[model samples]
Target: MRVLLVEDDQFHASYMEDVLAETLPEVTEIFHAMNGEEAEHEARALTIDAVVMDLRMSRRNGIDAARTLWMERPETRILFWSNYADEAYLRGIATIVPEDSAYGYLLKTAPRDRLKLALRAVLVEGQIMVDREIHRLQRRAASPRNTLDDSEFAVLLDLAIGLQDRIIAERRGMSLRTVQNRLLSLYEKLGVDDEASDAMPLNKRVRALNRALVTRTLNIETLETAQRDFDRWQSTRKRA
Candidate 1:
């Protein structure tokens, strides 16, 4: 079987190659790509049986790249190897994966045995293998009581990165009122307004962000990715 390993760090890529070589004897050829953009090109140029992709990359994120690949070849198998299990990344993966496709998500900190098992399950046996720690987040994501919808999630990311309501409204192509409504919904879901009788009430926006962070609903990696996206958007706006 031909496998494509997509990771930005060369050391990590080499490590993955070694692991695949040692674990999966059936893997005849292992291809490596530095990032998602290169992964896309390589997959299109060659016949890849399975892909091991990193979640975050400089050129393009793995979720976006996987979507493009699946658009062209829906049968392709994928195993996401990421350092983070952030909600945003999980949500992104859930959004793009085909209904019948076999896929998996494994954290980088997983034991070698678990990693090998996940790789085999998704890449060879065609099964779903999500990390145990991520299962709770997955359950919450599916739950309507506390989970943020796509619109709310987008607005939350914007707010987390210090975007003003007016700026978010303009960037998202929504009215100012719509932005405020989304913020209210976000705060509600995060329980930002639920204060104890003795505790001081913080600013709703700050409290919402704090709660999201405390709950692991929002994280540094998610914020970093959002900042990059925002920066790119701002650059495009400037150019326009």
Candidate 2:
């Protein structure tokens, strides 16, 4: 079986290469990509049957790359070996994978045997494999459809980084009223009942955004993605 190993860390990739080579003798060809951008290109160019990819990368994130890849090739098996099993990652992956296709989400901290098992399960048996913690998080939390949607998460990102509704509207190419509507949805989904919280003097938006941050959902990676988007938006505005 041919597999693509997508990771930004060279050492980690090399080590993983060794592990895969030793454990999975059926894996004949193993290609490597340092980031999601390269991974995307490789996926299109090569005869890859499966992929072991990282979630967070500098150029493009694994979720976006996986989405693109699956858009083109839905049957290709994916094994997400990530440093974080963040809810964002979970939500993102949930939207992309084919309704019937099997996949895996094993943590970076997992044992070597666990990684081997995930690799085999995803690539060979075509079964779902999530880390214990990720499974616990998934079970403890609401289903992806029940949680925040992408539009609401986009609004949350703006609020997480202190963006006003007017600015978020402009950045997202939506009307201010539409942005406000999304915020209302976000508040309800996040359960940021500022009205009930007597201690929080701030408005619902501030409280809701803060709740996301405190829960470690809206983290630096989220902010960085938003910042990169802002930079692109600013550049486009300047040009226009």
Candidate 3:
């Protein structure tokens, strides 16, 4: 099987190369790419059956690359290898993956055998795989399983995208008062100080967003997904 290895770190790239060579001997060609943009270019120019992608990188990330790659060819399988089993990453993965796509999310700390197994599952069996730890985090984050109700979470996404309360209410079919109330609840759940204290305004959404980001509740992938959704919503509204 021909594969594309997309990683930014030289050492990790070299390591992945060795793993591919040693573990999957049937893998005929392994293409190396430094970052997501390069990966996109190579994928467009080459015949890649599967891709082993790193989640974080400079310039562009694996999620962005994978989205574009799948857009180009939805049948290509993918293996996401990352050090972080972050819920944000898992959330982002959910948004970008094509319908009925075959993709695996494996931790970087996983053993070689585990890695090989996940690779084969995505590449051959067309199954989805996730590290148990990450899977638990995702499960725990789902509604009723954790804090933040759907309405409040919707407010969070709107806030993360820098939407005004009025616009958020309009988009979500909520009253302005209801939107503001949800934002307050979201702030409490996120442990953000949303009250005015002469230091910042009570409705300082920017500060709240920054706090959420530091807490890993809002990640780059989350932001990108939110932006995409917002853009689509805006476009649909325009047409209507």
Candidate 4:
């Protein structure tokens, strides 16, 4: 398999190349890029089987580049690598990629073997591998406002991410009062009577809900796979 790797850090880029070469001997060729712009250009220029991208970059950012690649190369698989485990990023990416595609979002600190496994799963199974932390975050976002309409769910997601009502309203092109009212309704549905209750800050409550969602969405088999992936990651770290 041919792969395109986009990462700015020299050490990580080199280390990843070495690991992939040693682990997946079938990866015949690997192309490297130092930034998002280069990645975007290379992605368009090459006939790569899959892309391994770093999220943080000096220009464009991984998500933007991934979106571009997804639009331009619908058949190419994308594997996102980031240090952040933010839910908003996951949701934003999900909005772009189809569920059937070979896509994955993983933490930069993930074990090398787990990274290899994620790539294999995408290439072989066409499954998207989400970092467990991201799955947890999504579950949290989904849980807190299960009764929320689509708009309300969007609003709550923004709220949990610390977006102000006015900012969210402007982004959604709705009035601030509408946002407030939606939040009030959501609180009622969640049975959260006190807005300032210690038991449920919007962020904390959302995270808890996300954990629950991950549990519900994953079956025993998939859960076992995730555990094995994580275990592989741990083992790689120990060796390193």
Q: Estimate every model's Cα lDDT from 0 to 1.
A: 0.87, 0.82, 0.83, 0.69
97-143, model 1: which lDDT tens digit per residue? 89889999998888889988988899999998899967765676546
**lDDT digits (tens) for residues 4-90 of candidate 2:** 999999888998999899889999999999888999999999988999989888898887788778888989999998887677676
Per-residue lDDT over 1-240 for candidate 4, one digit per residue giving the tens place of the 0 to 100 score: 889999999988898888778766668899999887898899878888888888777766777677788888788888888776654456556767854667889887888788878777775456878877666655675575454566765665555545678777866679999988887776665545544566645654454335424433322222232344345555875798
Lowest summed lDDT across 10 adjacent residues in model 3 is found at: 137-146
Better of 3 and 4 by TM-score: 3
Mark the regions of model 4 whose C-alpha exceeds 4 Å error after superposition. Answer: 136-150, 153-180, 183-240
TM-score of each: 0.72, 0.73, 0.81, 0.63
Ranking by TM-score, best first? 3, 2, 1, 4
State which candidate has the highest TM-score: 3
Model 3 score (lDDT): 0.83
Error of 4 at 203 (Å): 18
Ranking 1 against 2 by TM-score, winner: 2
Give the least accurate 10-residue stretch of model 1, judged by summed lDDT: 193-202
What's the candidate order when arranged by decreasing lDDT?
1, 3, 2, 4
Native-vs-model 2 lDDT? 0.82
The segments of candidate 3 whose C-alpha lies over 4 angstroms from its true place after superposition are 136-145, 149-154, 170-178, 193-207, 224-240
| RMSD to true structure for each model, in Å | 4.5, 4.6, 3.6, 13.0
